[model samples]
Target: MAIYLVGDIQGCYDSLCVLLDMAAFNPQHDHLYVTGDLVARGPDSLATLRFMQELGEHGHTVLGNHDLHLLAVAKGIMRPKARDKIRAILDAPDREKLLQWLRHQPLLIHNETKNETASGFVITHAGIPPHWTVREAKQSARDVEAILHSDRYLWLLQNMYSDEPSMWSSSLEGIEYYRYTINAFTRMRFLTMSGNLDMACKLSPDKMSDENLVPWFAAKRRETIKETIIFGHWAALGGIFQNNFLGLDTGCVWGGSLTMVRWEDGQKFNLSCPV
Candidate 1:
């Protein structure tokens, strides 16, 4: 069975279907790995949420920033943002079920089988920090995953944001600490050359400050994950760059296109949206 790693859906339900058909996806046989941002921005978040809930029963979804935000809004912990189009999902009958499913989703996934030793995988919604080893990154993710998979998840989600140490810290406090940690994993884009996060800027690296700001992947990091990583959420990164990691969120909600990648070979495909 082939595994098709899909990019951000962002509530473009019709485009998702078209892309799936184009991939010849057979959920009964092949697995679907989604990079998250399952809902928001587009017109059909309720449809996206339901469809993802169904697909996730048989597939895998790495939680994106949008997915987490949806949960926050659903729980009344936060309000809607400028680009969010999740009203339908918030009003849906099965909203609770969908949020529960999203909470249970992971932040990272990998398959370091005997397949491509040079490049296996380590999937997250956004890119990983350069300083953290693959093991370090996975462990941080696991910490949040535990909270997500636990009964105390509601507590964590309510306080999941911060301006903390500004770098990875082993001894963190409150759920807010963990929130910042997860945020970087799922929403990070620009990084200083020193490896600190530049969270304010949303422009591509080219348009950012010339100081030390660079794409997260551009860091001359110590290579721990010696495999190809696939992620989304930074639409500014565009799709499929540097021939190592894959950024699949081509901003379909902003008139970009939905994207998909063949897991084993890395072939690419997309479907355009009107935004």
Candidate 2:
């Protein structure tokens, strides 16, 4: 009974299958915790979504920025970009079922195993904001999640895109608050030393020329610093392991390897993207 935490699949269904095979994954006995971007930008969005949905209780995914974008596009709130290869998913026979499953997925997942030796891990598409404690991050996720599942979900999908309120504030209210929370959990990668999100910086940490900007995990006074956090979204960082943070987005869709890690033993498995 192993638990595998996987990086961004991003619609690379064949790569996912290869990695699962290499890990000898048994859906009946093993569990998969995917760090989002389950669809878009790869060769097989429809197959990827279908496979994840079929996993049922054995698998679950945190919502990435691309996942949210899919919802928005499906709902006619946003148009698909030229680079987005999600039309197959939108046109699939089970498109509604797949999208519904994705919409219901959580923005944050806290896994506290019963085993005394297992360390608890929080999985999110992107890293949590430095100002948020684990509890606060969970609460913020719930706030947006509730809306995503509610009748007014279309409203959220329509209004969720924005870069304002770049810093966390307890007083943030309404759609502004939800947008900020969503960005932090899905699109955030770098932050200024002052704790404001550097939305424009998407390069790997070493490549960035801005001395004032730092990765979210490197921010000082982060409340979730004591807990282990597993996230994807930043493919530029590849498989970064720093302190209590583990980054698993190895850019599989961009010709890198698909990576997965077993939580109990910390053993990693990778499958190179097909040429």
Candidate 3:
């Protein structure tokens, strides 16, 4: 039974299937863990969500920013952007079922099975904030996930769109807590010199014009983390593998290849996007 970790599909169903086939994934036995952004921006948001739903126990995904936005749009909290391409999902007969499943997904996945280089791995839509240890991240994610999976979820989806409280604080509560948790888990990329989230910068590290900003993984950590961090929100990274960190959003919707990594042996598979 192999375990595979895939980058953002973003509705590129054909590319995802091809990449999985190239890796010879057998859903009957092998598990497929996605780094989120399962739908949006590509041609088949409806089909992509359906496929992931069908995967059932074989598939797992964290929630991406786009996934959260889809929920908000479906709930009439916001209108979909013209470029979103998620109308199919909103119009689907099983839209409620699909979005419910997505909403119930967590902001982080942690596996404790030991590997040679690290204790295990944790997957998030974006890289973990440098200020939190793995245990702290797990608790933070659970706190947000509890709200996301509860009746107050609409409130969470509505209030989750802000960019304030750029840094973590123990005293933060209510909307500040939820917003910061969502941003750090889904939209984070760079950190300012003072270790606050630089939410406005989406450029890759080398392309970043601000010398004071560094990728979240590069920022000084609150403590040394022993687990590998896997994330996929930064397509500009073009797939990064360094030390214990792996960034796998290769921009399949933007003409780059879809990517997958076999968790046991660390072998990677890529299929060029035909979308």
Please report the candidate that would top lDDT against the real structure: 2
lDDT of 3 by residue, 39-112 (tens): 88988889889988899999999999999999999999999977799988888889899988989999999988
Off by over 4 Å in 2: 114-117, 222-224
* Candidate 3's TM-score: 0.97
Report the lDDT tens digits of candidate 2 across residue range 1-275: 89999999999999999899999999998999999999888899889889988999999899999999999999888999888999988888889999999999999999866466568899999989888888899999999999999998999998888898898889999998999999999999999988898799889988999899999888876544566899999999988876789999999999998999988888899888964
- Pairs that collide in candidate 1 are 119-227, 120-227
Number of clashes recorded per candidate: 2, 0, 0
lDDT of 1 at 250: 89
**CA lDDT scores, all candidates in order:** 0.80, 0.91, 0.90
Report the lDDT tens digits of candidate 1 across residue range 204-274.
Answer: 77777677687888777776557677889888767865567778888888898988887767667788888
Can you give the lDDT of residue 184 in candidate 1? 78
True-structure Cα RMSD, model 3: 1.2
What TM-score does model 2 achieve against the real structure? 0.97
